[model samples]
Target: MKFLLVEDNLDLANAVTSRMLMDGHVVDHAEKIEDAKLFSDTGEYDLILLDIMLPDGDGRSFLEHHRAKKRDTPVIVLTARSQVSDRISLLDLGADDYMTKPFDHAELQARVRAVLRRNHGSSQPVISVGDVSFDPVAGQMRVKGTPVKLRNRELRLFELLINAPNQIFSKQKLCDRLFTFDEDVSENAIEVYIGRLRKHLEPSSVTITTHRGLGYKLDPR
Candidate 1:
C-alpha cells in the first residue's frame, strides 16, 4: 500500500514513515498543508495519514477541500487533538479513522490495514474467488489450498480481478489503477501482466477474458 503522510513533527514523521516502510508500505511525507495538497492532487495513494495540526493549516480544512473534489481516498487523522468533538467532527467530515498522539504502533498498523480492507469492501484478510484465495497483506496466493507463485505485477492484477470478480476492467483503467501515478508504465504493461496471469490462472478456472476493444474481465468459475 502507498501512504501519503502529512505531519509537521519531523521526528514523529520520520518514526512513522520508517515503521511503515519496515512493515512494507510505500510512504511519502509532507510537512505542510500546501505540500500535502499538492501530493494529494497528483498521487494515487491507498491512504492519507493526515495530522490535524500542520504548519500551514488545520488538517480538517484540508480534508474538507479534498472531499469537495469527490475524492474518496480514505484518510486516517493522526493528531494530538484527542477531543471527542474533534474526533466526531473529523469523522463527520469523512475521515475513515483517527488515532491520537502517543498511540500504540501495532494499533496504528492494524488500523491502516483495517481501513484499507474496508475501503476495498471487505474485512477478510484473505479474499477468495473460486479455487483461488489471495492474502493481500502477505501478498500470497493459494489455489485450492496449494501455494501459487506469482510475480509482483501478476499478483496485483490478479488481486484487482479477484476483488471485483466477474467485472470488466478496461485496459486503460486497469493501467491507471494498478500502478502508482509516478510509475513510467503503460496500458500495454497491464495487458502483458494480464496475459501472464492468465497463463497461470486460466487453466485453474479463474479465467481472464478479453472483451476486445473494451478490455479484460476475470471470471472465477
Candidate 2:
C-alpha cells in the first residue's frame, strides 16, 4: 500500500515511515499542508494518515478539500484531539478512522487494516487467487498453506496483483504503486520484479501474464 503521511513532526513521521517501510508499504511524507496538498494532487495513495494541526493549516480543511474533490482514498486522522466531539467531527468530515496521539503501533496497524477492509468492502482479511494467498495485514503470502519466502518488493508486486485478480495494470501504474515518487526506476524494473515473482509462484497455479502493450495481469492458469 502507498500512503501519504501528512505530518509535520519529524520524529513521528520518521517512526511512521520506518514502520510502514518495514511492512512493505511505500510512504510519501509531507511536513505541511502545502506539501500535503501537492502530494494529494499528484500521488495516488491507498491511504492518508493526516495530522490535524499541521504547520501551515488545519487538517480539517484538507479533508474537506479532499472530499470536495471526490477522491475516496481512505484517510485515518492522527491527532492529539481526543474529545468525542472531535472524533465525531472528523468522521463526519470523511475520515475513515481516527487515532489519538501516543497510540500503539500495533493498534494503529490494526485500525489501518480494518479501515482498508471496510473500504474495499471485503469482510475477509485474506485475499487469494488460485493457490496463492496473501494476508495483507500480516504481509504474508502462502502457497498451499506453506509460507513463501519473497523479498519486500517482490511481495509487494505480487500482493498488488493478487488483490485484484485478472485486472490488467499498466507498467506506469505498477511502477507508481510499487516504487515511491522519488525513487529512480529503470524502464524494465517492473519486468524484473514480475520475473522474480513468477519464479516464486511457479509451483502454484497463479501466473503473471503480460500484455504486449497494455501491461500485466495475474490470473490462475
Candidate 3:
C-alpha cells in the first residue's frame, strides 16, 4: 500500500515510515499541512496518516478541506490528544481512525489493516487468487500453501494484482504504486517486474495477462 504520512516530528515520522516500509508499504512523508496538501494532490495513496499538530497548520482544517472536495481517501489521524471529545471532533471532521501518540506499533499496524480491509470491503486478511495466496500483514506469498520466494518488487506487484483480481492496471499506475517519489522508475521496470512475477507464478493456477495497448490483468489460468 502507498501512504502519505503528514507529521512534523522528525523522529516519529522516521520511526513510523521505517515500520511501514518494513511492512511492504511505500510512504511519502510531509512535515506541514502545505506539503501534505501538495503530496495529496500529486500522488495516489491508499491511506493518509495525518498529524493534528503541524508546523504550518492543524490537520483538522486539512481534513475539512479534503472532505469538502469530496475525496473519499481513508485518513487515520495521529494525535497526542487523549480526550474523547478531541477524537470525536476529528472523526466528525472526516478522519477514519485516530491513533494517540505513544501507541503500540503492532496495534497501529492492525488498525491500518482493519481500515484497509474495511475500505476494500474484504473481511479476510489473506487475499487469495486461485492457488496463489498473499498475506499483506506478513508480506508473504504462497502458492498451493507452499511459500513462493519472490523479489521485493515482484511481491509488491503480485500483492497489488491479487488484491484486485481481474482489474486492469495500466503500466503507469503500476509504476506509480510500486515506486516512490524519488525513485527513478520507468514503464520498462514495471514490465521487468511483471515478467519475473509471471515466471514465478507459472506453476500456479493464476496468470497475468497483458492487455496489449491497455496494460495488465491477473486472472485464473
lDDT score for residue 123 of model 2? 72
Question: Candidate 3, residues 79-190: lDDT per residue as tens digits?
Answer: 9999999999998898999999989888888899888878877676888888889987567899889998877778888888997896999999898888877788779999
Q: Poorest 10 consecutive residues of model 1 by lDDT?
A: 174-183
- The clash count of every prediction, one per candidate, is 0, 0, 0
Between which residue pairs do clashes occur in model 1? none
lDDT of 1 at 54: 81
Q: Write the per-residue lDDT of candidate 2 for residues 74-100, one digit (tens) a residue.
A: 999999999999999999999999999
Q: Assess every candidate by TM-score.
A: 0.72, 0.91, 0.88
Of the candidates numbered 1 and 3, which has the greater lDDT value? Answer: 3
| Model 1 Cα lDDT, one tens digit per residue, 1-221 | 66789999899888888888765566778888898888889766778999998878799888998899899999999989888998999999999999999898889988988888888786667888778788887778887788888876677677778878868888877765566455678677886898788777854767888888888887755
lDDT of each: 0.82, 0.88, 0.88
Specify the highest-TM-score model's number: 2
| Window of ten residues with lowest summed lDDT in model 3 | 116-125
For lDDT, the strongest prediction is 2
